[model samples]
Target: MDAFSEFIRGITRDNPILGLVLGLCPALAVTTSVENAIGMSVATAFVLVCSNVFISTLRKQIPSAVRLPIFIIIIATFVSIIRMVMEAYVPSMHAALGIFIPLIVVNCIIIGRAEAYASKNNVFFSFVDALGIAAGFLLVLVLIGGIREILGTGQIVAFGYTLLSLPINPAVTTMIMPPGAFLTIGIIMAVVNYQRAKKRAKGG
Candidate 1:
């Protein structure tokens, strides 16, 4: 039950994206398309999960003062691994993601999880926590990306396969711009907050 609670907490009560609002940089930057958002979220999830497990294993030995530096090194190493692999096998995704891929090293979501939860929990729990947070982040990214892609471009494609294409306009066009992303996220956040308030009022 404790483990389940931790999992739920990571997704909702303490979401790294929405609730805690940790990694807004990458969240807002790479979500121009669903594919880019998914790639970035997956890359960050890999690093977060691995770093959390490692940090938890070494928690006892890490000196309090040196822990931050050590954690950064560990996170950076994993980010490098992702970068190399993406460049080698998935060059297009690598190119599309751009600097944001390497920037995962500094993503607050990964670092915050490592310090706050992973460093203190067991390896298995750390994995669960990382998964929950990653899912929550991915959820937000997909929502933002989907809205932008459909409204802006009139089409939604993943890895070259078209999922849905609107017939109303061949090009709404504005959805691909920076302002579209901001507008979509703002409205979504507002709706989510309203729903939460409604649930609370009903004693949920």
Candidate 2:
């Protein structure tokens, strides 16, 4: 397979969040604003790329019987590193993310990629795949965050700077809440499915 095509596929065709439907918990939970979305994306991308490279490198020596255990350990190690780094440099985000940071250990996106792609691929391809998938995840989070933030707050702010300001007496508070997250996701899914159906009908 062409490496470039594979990388593009992860962003559009096989997006971990939008297409594959993996890693939805953080996508919904930490996407209240652009700031939170960026924070979560950075931590997740770090762990995903690190774990993919490491697992792919050792794929040959790792025995099948013990691969799952090995994968968990490897992924956990990276997750812990990300946790510490975020806590030290970005404590606010660290606290904001809460248990979800450590919970990355169980994130199916990480483990699933490790087993399904990393464990069988070369390091370079795995690295490329990780980058593409992580980028796709980040992009989706940012999009969702933007939508929710704008709808719920009537504005968008990042690092104390306002990116957008809308005139609304009272923003729809539900959009930033759990119900809002679900609603945004449901709408996006419906739109995506409709597009896919249309494409299939045209034999594309």
Candidate 3:
């Protein structure tokens, strides 16, 4: 039950994107389409979960003074693995995500989780936490990407299948640009914040 609670907490109560507001660079950069968003999410999830497990396993052995360097090395190793796998297989996604893929090594969400949760918890718990946080981040990425794609391009596709086609509007082109990404995420953050405030007021 404690682990389950931790899982839920990572997703909503402490979401890396919305609640903690970490990893915004990639969140905004690679979220132009659903496919790219999913790719980035999966890549980050792999790095986060694997790094957390390894960190948790070696928590005691890692000296406190050098923990940051150790964490970066571990994270870089996983990021390299992700980069290699994506380059060899999903070359399109690899190209679309571009530099952002390599930048995941420095993403605060990964490092923050390692320092805050993985460094203090058991391997199993850290894995659960990583999964939950990754899911939460993926959820936001998809939502943002879906909105941008549907409004900007008038279509939403998962893999090669079309999910929905919007009625075309000449004015909707803004959604495909940087300003739209900021606006979409800002509105979402506002809504989430409001709901949380309401829940707090009602003692939820």
- lDDT for model 1, please: 0.87
Worst lDDT 10-window in candidate 1: 167-176
* Per-residue C-alpha lDDT of model 3 across residues 98-195, encoded as one tens digit per residue: 99999999999999999999999999999999999999999999999999999989999889999999778763878878988999999999999899
Candidate 2 structure quality by residue, lDDT tens digits, 81-148: 99998899989989988999999899899999998899999999999999999999999999999999
Instruction: State the C-alpha lDDT per candidate.
Output: 0.87, 0.93, 0.93
Better of 1 and 2 by lDDT: 2
TM-score of each: 0.95, 0.97, 0.97
Candidate 2 residue 111 Cα shift, in angstroms, is: 0.4
Clashing pairs in 2: none
Best by TM-score: 2
